[model samples]
Target: MMGRTVLVTGGSSGIGRAVAARFAADGADVVITGRRVDTVAPAAEALGVRGLACDATSPGQVAALAGELGGSLDVLVNAAGGLPAAPAAGTPPLEALAQEWLSSVSGNVLTAVLTTTAVRDRLAPGGAVISVGSIGAERRGGSYGAAKAALAAWNVSLAAALGPQDVTCNVISSGYVAGTGFFGDGMTEERHRALVEETLLKRPGTPDDIAQTILFLASPGARHITGQTIHVNGGAFTTR
Candidate 1:
């Protein structure tokens, strides 16, 4: 990856940060983005990579980020997404529900779609576009899960479109990865244990676990793989 240019959205922390770190370690020209400058700057400086503040869900911001790239991108990791904030208090229940659902889809699905669209032309042939998906999409994930499921559905179309150009697109559907602040402080001991127990590995999934998988997808070895939702859930969710 010495000559590669990789862009990781939401790379200031968690799995995105780990992915950026891995690419930097391998000598890729890495650029990371966060919604806030304060977080993006320090993270980029600490990782010895370029940092930009871009809201992945905003078309204008994402377009500007593409312009700043200046060169073709080799790998794009769409890791900018999370659970939406709760709706304001005193709002009507129906309105609050609508707000939460919309926010969930925007943060998770639109973030990936808008960013990828903005940089689609900047991707060189053979470049890879990888997005972080979730097992929640498979079960009782509610609106957030529905958004992730939509992301995977969208990836299939993207892969078909980009396949002719020799660019690859895929989703990494992870299960219960720790250290991502995914559940915030809501993860109780019993809940954590239950999640791990569901996995065949009987252990927690780490950021490195997902990052290593993303690295492989971006590598030459995974060149033939595209339009697929590869599960990295320690067997917590089985396909067959």
Candidate 2:
């Protein structure tokens, strides 16, 4: 990855931050974007990376991000997404459903689609795209799972479109990532235990687990792999 340029969205925290740092440590010129400049800027500086304040859901911001780091992109990681605030207890079924579904789709599917479309041309040959996905899509994922499922579908079309350019696209479906703010304040000890129990490994996943997979996909070792979703779930979910 020496001298290569990579971009990771949502680099202010969690898996995004870990992935950005990992890439920077590998000698790649890393660029990170997030909605909050204050948090993301400090993070970028700490890692000796460039920080861009861009909302992945905004087309204009995405275009600007592409232009700013355009023409030399070797990898793009769409890690800027998550569930919004949960609905109030006892809220109407329609109202609660609407909010979660919208938030999930906007944060997950739309963000990746807009970012990928904005930078498709700037992506270099041998480049790769790695989007953060979820194991939720397999269970009763609700709106979040629905959005993640859509992301996988989009990846197939993206891979086909970019195949001619030698830019492979794939999704990394993560499960039970520990040390991340994925659950916000609702992750209770009992819930945590239940999550661990669901996994075959009987342990939670770390950001490094997902980051290493991203690195592998971007490396020459995975040059032929594309249009597929790789699971990093610690055996929480399996496909026979």
- The CA lDDT of each predicted structure is 0.93, 0.92
Question: Any residue pairs clashing in model 2, and if so which?
Answer: none
Query: Best by lDDT, which number?
Result: 1
Worst 10 residues of 2 by lDDT: 64-73
Candidate 2 residue-wise lDDT, 24-64, digit = tens: 99999999999988888899898889999999988988888
Error of 1 at 115 (Å): 0.8
Q: TM-scores across all candidates?
A: 0.98, 0.95
